[model samples]
Target: MSVTTTTPETTSTTQPKKRRLRTPYFQVVASLAWKDLRAEARGREMVNAMLLFSIMAVLIFSFALELDRQAQEATVGGVLWVTIAFAGTLGLGRSLAAEKDKGSLDALLLAPVERSALFYGKMIGNFLFTLAVGFLLVFLLTVLFNVNLFRPVLWLIIVLGCLGFATTGTLVASMSVHARAREMLLPILLLPVILPVIISATRASTALITELKTEDWLPWIQLLGVVDFVFLLAGFFLFDFIVEE
Candidate 1:
């Protein structure tokens, strides 16, 4: 009996599945930015320092010069921008230094994510922080300078100003964080490059406050928009190189 049972060929139903790869770009960026915010919230050091510095700036401006309503009106733009700029520097310096000191920067670099996202995340976080400081300054300055800083036009100027400031500040902070004299180096390196933004923003803000022709304010606002776009795009391209080093 040739019991040659023809064994049916077994069809293999299992196959190796392709794995989906996650880049972690958004996740890493959000976590990194959130880390900074959470740390600042817990300590309250950065916000407190900025508030104190802004208040002091307002006080100094109030007493620095004798000014009636016209003079104060003319000078309001300068005072508000200067206060925000100085306080912004303080916050930027502290935020970057904290990351560097804690080795979080290195870890973030090692994370498998596109570097541009990191820049955007940091910039957005800084923008929010600086915007808070700016709003507070506007309120305090309105009282101190006796000027109506809450105007819709003035608010628009503030938005443009904050955008410009945050974009440049984030990029500069990336570079300055790695330097030996990072704390001191940031302002020197940052201020020169961002002067155009400050000048345009200040001028626009002043024009808006004084009810000048829209043509006068329009040019400055346009200039501010250009600067913001330039810095933002430049930072996006350059962040990868900065982080690699």
Candidate 2:
């Protein structure tokens, strides 16, 4: 009787399965996002800059308006969204610029990771940072402007706004990172494109804060949802072209 070992063949068959388990789309994106989060947690350079810029911008806008109670409420929408845009742009630009400067982006691209997964990872990382600043802005806007900004609908607007902001901002940042003046170039490319999101967010937030009827707020919220969807879709499809260059 010849004793033949089938263990090698069985191990070879299971090898592919093990590899497949490690490379699921969600897991890859999670690992990539976690890499960024861990790095940020250790140094905190990006989050620190974003928070500082947002806080100062909000305070300046509050003081500059110099409005009466009614006037403050009227201008709050513009003030809040504008502050988030500024801070988010700054954060997005620096985050990608830092990656490009260190050549980590190239390494990330070289990995056997899906392009869409890479996009989501970067998009989620940017969104979390931007969202943090947005929440802080909400708190500051409430205290400084003496307006109630922490409503269910208003929080929804922040969620949608940050989602749209991060998607568009990340796409633009990847494109601008190779430019000579990426910090300057990022806003030029980013702000014009994200106008719809800003408008819809501002409108929805204003209506919610004003205690408008449900029907009135829903349309703007729907428009915000549409804008966020469009940008996120664009980022998902276009990230390959931008990064693979």
Candidate 3:
């Protein structure tokens, strides 16, 4: 009993431990998104490239068409989404390829965080970057081409289109990251798989900007919703396997 005396450090250790905080799934996703966003903020490389490319692409399309107001209205929808698709492909491919090439992607996968959460994190970051380009295109195209591109219906199309586009692009980029011709492989693989999103997005956007009829775009909007849901579900269930590969 006399030898049972404890040091202060030991006594402190014997006290009850504080409860650990459990992070919610949504918060985890946000953390992941924030991590990517923080890195992007520091670099400003990817967004700058995408923004410049999109602006030039829109400018080229605007001038190339040489369309009157009626023709401009009819074609602006295609130009906008096509620019987004092209710039989006480049953004997604580079973002993930850099992570994989630098070994950061492996480190992230080895983390205790869930894979679906990682997908959401990367997906949201990609979506936001793509949406930024979309917004810039809207502004420049509106001013340069004198077309109205800021309607609420078109906003909805942008939201949904970016969702499906980002999800599919992220998933495919993960698969293509290690490929030798990833630059070529990325778009070749991505465009075919995401064709539905492209079609529905273009159709709905055309209805909004060209026809100005919400009712006519409803079916295309529903199609986009279904495609986005399917892509997101696939990414959630399959990303772990892709990372493993």
Candidate 4:
């Protein structure tokens, strides 16, 4: 029998490489996302607070407004987007702050998985939560505003809008979690940055609600998609640096 000897350099390089390849990237991301979901499911605080806040906001807007068909068409979009923005902001701030408080963020940062995967995992969790809020808002708007928001295109717009919001909001929330006034700082940092998303979503949603031509609303949706892509890129590249800092 011939015996083969492994060199130290090859052993060192290949062992770490094997370890890196051992854990699939998608598995890491899914596990991280599942962690958030499991935590939220156990505590129920995050989703409860978000749903309560959203319902109250919807009720207030429904009662506060006196709008004709044309007015509702124009203003419903703004109301929906505004409520989503605020509720999503609340959710993002609380989620990250809790992680920071529990030292889970530290654990995550120290984990062997990729930083960008961490960002995406957190973002997916936030996206799902915010998407639930968005769906609820749609139904509430349909009933309260007497406007039909049940269209597929409108739902698509909502998905894109929430994706963009989650992408940017995740990055900003991570940045602000270390701040003393994170509650205040998150909105300040996030709102201005996601203005493009809000504006596009609002306009596209309004156009769709009003039964405007495809050309009118399609461009806004496209713009929202582009914004989501850009934010995703920014977060993917910058999360590593931000978490490092």
Candidate 5:
């Protein structure tokens, strides 16, 4: 039996498989944005401050201008956009500064995600915050200004304006966060860059509110769309360099 025994050859069937490294861009972006939203929601500090400031700004405008029916209808666009811009800036500054201060920004950078993902994440988060503030401002302004801001066109303007503002603001904030006076630097850097957006948004919104011809407002809307596209693309491309520095 021992002489007749044959040795069975064993073949190795187990081999280590190589994993293809996937860039978790969308996942990273969504996670980071969600984290910021959760933090902001839990604290409520940024939203509360923005809301209070917007209210105060509206009150000041109401009392300062004594906007009668005609004046209110005429200036509502400027008033609403100005209030939203200021309040939104406050939120953006706080959001980025908190991340920089907490060292979470570094951790985020260290993650195996594309830098553009981080930029989009921050921009989306800021956009949501500003959009909320803008919506609140629209509602309050409509009541105070006695203008019908609930129009669909006005909502579209708000969406476009918010997208433009957030795209530019996030990029500027990334640079300003590293500066010595980040709080001051952020607005200085951001406001100048986003002036085109503000002006175009205000004009487009005004046209919509006043029931002007679409042709008259089309240019402004186009300008806003162009500005948003440029900034969004620029931010996406420049984010990696900005973070590295």
Candidate 6:
């Protein structure tokens, strides 16, 4: 038998290849988020459903209420938050459920990565999808309600609000995915938990939309940020346990 020889050049090349398999934590997060993003871009299933729902909700509300200019400005915040909350819930459930159905979730679980990284990856994908719906809703509201919803402050609130919703939603969706009635169960479990965030976001958006004083809207915005941080912390600490089950 020929003797096995290990050259320095071969050893160095082989070692780097082995190390490459040990992916960095953030790289894992990016890869996972990118995977979901690519799948969503290719399929367009989740985002399209969410967009349709958002559009219908905006149209139905606008037609049903027939709000005057003043009324539109005043009520637009409520409409925006309600649409985001429901649509985000739909996207979140679909994201995780798709993984489960495809057996991809099991493979992800078996990968050499921190569970929290997985949570952040999933949360980032859900956040971006929901944020896209939120932006579309803003544009639709502007066109349909004849209100200018392009205020810098309002967009900031939407970002923070969607961030909070996605953080909490990702965790809850994971928990509900193993259930038979996950579609039903996710919202039931999620809406109640996310009610506080929705309320804060609604109040903040309403204040800003109605052109209230800084004192009026600032408190609500601050509260929204705090709630978002709490949820983020909760997801960070709790997601590992959730995925394990």
lDDT against true structure, model 2: 0.86
Per-prediction TM-score: 0.89, 0.89, 0.88, 0.90, 0.90, 0.90
**What range of 10 consecutive residues in model 2 has the weakest lDDT sum?**
13-22
Q: What is the TM-score (0 to 1) of candidate 1?
A: 0.89
Model 4 — which ten-residue stretch has the worst lDDT?
12-21
Root-mean-square deviation of each candidate, in angstroms? 4.0, 6.3, 5.5, 6.4, 4.7, 6.6
Residues 140-237 of candidate 6 have per-residue lDDT tens digits of: 99999999999999999999999999999999998998899998999899999999889999999998888989999999999999999998898889
Predicted candidate 5 versus true structure: per-residue lDDT over 9-74, tens digit per residue? 998898889886756679988988999899988999998998899999999997798856866777
Per-residue lDDT for 184-223 in model 4, tens only?
8999999999999999999999999888899999999999
Candidate 4's C-alpha lDDT?
A: 0.91
Candidate 6 regions with alpha-carbon error over 4 angstroms: 1-21
- Compute the lDDT of residue 205 as modeled in candidate 3: 84
Q: List the residue pairs that clash in candidate 4.
A: none
TM-score of model number 4: 0.90
Between candidates 3 and 5, the one scoring higher on TM-score is 5
Residue ranges of candidate 5 with Cα displaced over 4 Å: 1-23
Cα lDDT, all candidates: 0.86, 0.86, 0.88, 0.91, 0.87, 0.91
**In model 6, which range of ten residues has the least summed lDDT?**
11-20
Better of 1 and 3 by lDDT: 3
Query: Is candidate 2 or 3 superior in lDDT?
Result: 3
Candidate 1 residue spans exceeding 4 A from truth: 1-20
Q: For model 4, how many clashes?
A: 0
Backbone clashes, each candidate:
0, 0, 0, 0, 0, 0
